[model samples]
Target: MKKTVCAIIIAAFSVCVWLQNAGAEDIKIGSILRLSQGASDGLPARRGVEIAVKEINAKGGIGGRKVEVIFEDSKDTDQAAVAAFQKLVSMDGVKVVIGPMKSSEVLAVAPIAMREKIVVITPNGTSPKISEAGEYVYRGCSRIDKQAEALTQFAKDPMKATGVAILYSNEPYGKGCNDLFTKQFTALGIPVVAVESFMVGDRDFSAQITKLKQSTFDLLFIPGYLQETAPAIAQARKMGIVAESMGVYGDMAPKYIELAGKAAEGHINASEYDEDYATGKNKKFKDAYYSIVKADANEPNNIMFAALTYDAMGLVAEAIAAKGNSPDGIRSYLDSVKDFDGVTGKLSFDANGDVVKQGVYIFKVQDGKYVKVK
Candidate 1:
């Protein structure tokens, strides 16, 4: 009897040790983002991933292994993004990566991701070219052309603008939006009168605005990051050019309103997440996000980017949970997933790896807040 009791105790000890070892093993993931340049979007997105990871681990992580995310800054450049991807995959040994939010970065890293068979999900890379990036490359947001489709129609029916002028950022995303929206507006029978360009990090838009003022149009469309677009609109207003202002998804931030001041009023843009979206998931996410970021003055508050990444992290976790941690497993799970209830909306992946969400949202700034138009 003494020998039997000792054997049972040893067996229990071994089981406990095994369980501890299993729990100690972490499932690593990688995140590449614009942590330095354009951190307003990148920082919030990082917070979103943090929130999702925290929540996932809090509930006894996937298959008893804690999720560990290795974050790398893309520096808002294609070469940096490629280096980050290689480092994350080779050194960190992460099977899946979520980031390099810019379309250019995503495109830059696509070939490597495909060659290595790494699963990559970009939260905000909206250029239509990304649809053909690779089988392993996935996006979490709607394409820019889709936003143009919705915004251009809204401009035609409600805004009732006859002619439109564009001031586009010369970067890939901004230039892509300019081309797509110009086509969309023209398709809707709204002639694009004057087109101008501005470089990223450009604070002074007086030259562009001065030239834009030379053109007569009932509507002014500026497609670029709010850092430049907001100030451009402000300068345009200051320089005495008053036409209904429109922008792309980059303008959907509180900072835009703050920067543009009263100039932001009546400015319309596209959005992914709606705060008024009544869902327990959304409520929990918003509560958690504000609770964390509201106290940190250095943290930029843009829930849209955060929400997209939150959903991206959550979906990746779910994929890992269901299909295992391999790239093929995650890709299969993503391809098969339908109607994932996310903070943004019901999300699913199409054949092209583009997210099929509810659709784009049109929002106008009113009283210092974004009000949904359609």
Candidate 2:
């Protein structure tokens, strides 16, 4: 009878311990990314978040709670993004989300995020409209206007181009860049000779290039994602259109050089993150990222997308650790924090939840590598 009593007491004590541990359960975070359709950019962005989460968990996690990320594929479409985001909010009960890499997708989910009072931070959606999306929406990348500013400056002093032509994607992001960069370039005294656009998945640029070739321009600015931009530039070069090629942040990837091949040489673009910044954290991140990428040959890796998303994940982890898992808690902490060191740069969110780093690095592709030009 005494032995039985002791056994019961031990069982009860074990249950109490288990209940306590369960109370301090893992903190869940949601991520909706373009895992399939736009995997080139999305895969690197996801890897950034994965690295941050892995490092955070290794260091005892957030506030003693193991951080868990629930990932959903956005499929790079508006309908898919909305569904993925709704699933995260409804089924996972996630208060914070990082994803929907495209501006259109982010815009599609913005209303729902605002209504649900969830925090949504996009690492690569650079539409200026996103600045006014909602209080619940934040962006880890510079707006299209900011990227245009850097590229325009480069156009004036370095390229010394008197006239430029634009070949942009027809989507929201591409259209925004075309408009903003044109304004910035014209403001800098560079006249826009021609403007042409192609659909998102357009593999043939023969028609677009024919029109662009007719325009007498010294510089060719293609401000779309690398997938289309690279091929377009390659076709333009093959057609003997020798206008110097330039682009925005999306063109900074090594894949751009690989896709454009010899045409990628002398290509100019702006980047938010400098891979050779010489910062200790950046060095560590690059080393870890290269190690991870080495293990998986199929996954695409790029500095701009990875660094931005890495900083986004770090920001989320900081906010969660400082405040809690609540949306308001994360926002409150994010608003007040400053000079948070990240692989991208010293990141601080402004009132609109836009990353406050004002500087953009000018990069040129030389010998199939991104060399910092300014």
Candidate 3:
């Protein structure tokens, strides 16, 4: 009876100690992301954050505090993103927030984040609208204009396209990309024949295809992530209303190609990060990425947005550690951040919370794989 009582007393003491330790220092970072539950682009976005958090925790953590991520699904909706951001800041009390795979979602979250004085970083929300979203908004990756500008610089030859059509998902992200693509193509002397918008969730492209079939656009600028774009392409290809010169990118995923099948072969997808961009840092990431995810994957596995998203979280942690983990100090440190050497390459943000780096490589699948064309 005495021994059993002693054991009970020790167990009770252990529980109390564990509870004390658990409450000591748990730093919560809000992850306002579309994730897998939101959109097809989210699969890799989540993977990137998971990978970085694991690596960061293994490296002694942020200032000896245990880091915790609070994931709130925004579902790629404006209202949902605004609500998620409120919940993260007002309820969960995350010191720093990262992500929302889509730009439209990022825009909704940014104003709230600015009001709360929290640091909100995007892996890749390149819509020019995000630059002035708020004081707290930061982008680890480059924006659409740069990517589009890069595409226009390198792929104008392919546009051998005398006339092209601009089809976009009637959303901010799609509209943003098409506006630039149309301007660039027109600058190259390619006339834009058809500029149409489709509802975000619409799957049937028959209506759009019928219109295109009757037109003479040699190319098309179909933008937006795969959920809508993929099915639209499949339907267009099925109708033999294919563009002589066509491509899509900015929201590249394996499913885009997989869902598009034979039609996806010659389709050029632009990317912000080229696996072969530079040396050491670039190569190491690629080798590790392929070994684990396998080389046969169909998606844009090496998406810089995802890698940069992971890096964005780590940047917040590092900044927090440097500034005593206080929100204000971290925000100040963030402003001072210049040319941060990240997994994607050198990251330098401008006054409006935009990165200075420019260029998005146009990639194509040669044999069921994405190969950098330039």
Tens-digit lDDT track of model 1 for 1-374: 99999999999999999997765689999999889988999999999999999999999899988999999999988999999999999998999999989988999999999999999999999888899998999999998888888899999998888999999999877888888888888988999999999998899989888998888898999998899999999999999989999998889999999999999999999999999899999999999999988798888989999999999999999999999999999999999999999999999999999999889989999999999988
lDDT of 2 by residue, 288-338 (tens): 888878888887878577888889989999999999899999999888889
Identify the leading candidate in terms of lDDT: 1
Which residue pairs show backbone clashes in model 1?
none
Give TM-scores for every candidate, taking all chains together and pairing residue i with residue i: 0.93, 0.92, 0.83
Question: Where is model 1 more than 4 Å wrong at Cα?
Answer: 1-23
RMSD of each: 4.7, 3.3, 4.2
**Candidate 3: deviation at residue 136, Å?**
1.2
Q: What is the C-alpha lDDT of each candidate?
A: 0.93, 0.89, 0.72
Q: Stretches of candidate 2 above 4 Å error?
A: 1-22
- Compute the lDDT for candidate 3: 0.72
Instruction: Write model 3 residue lDDT over 270-305, tens digit each, in one string.
Output: 776666667665565556555646654544453554
Which of 1 and 2 is ahead in lDDT? 1
Top candidate (TM-score):
1
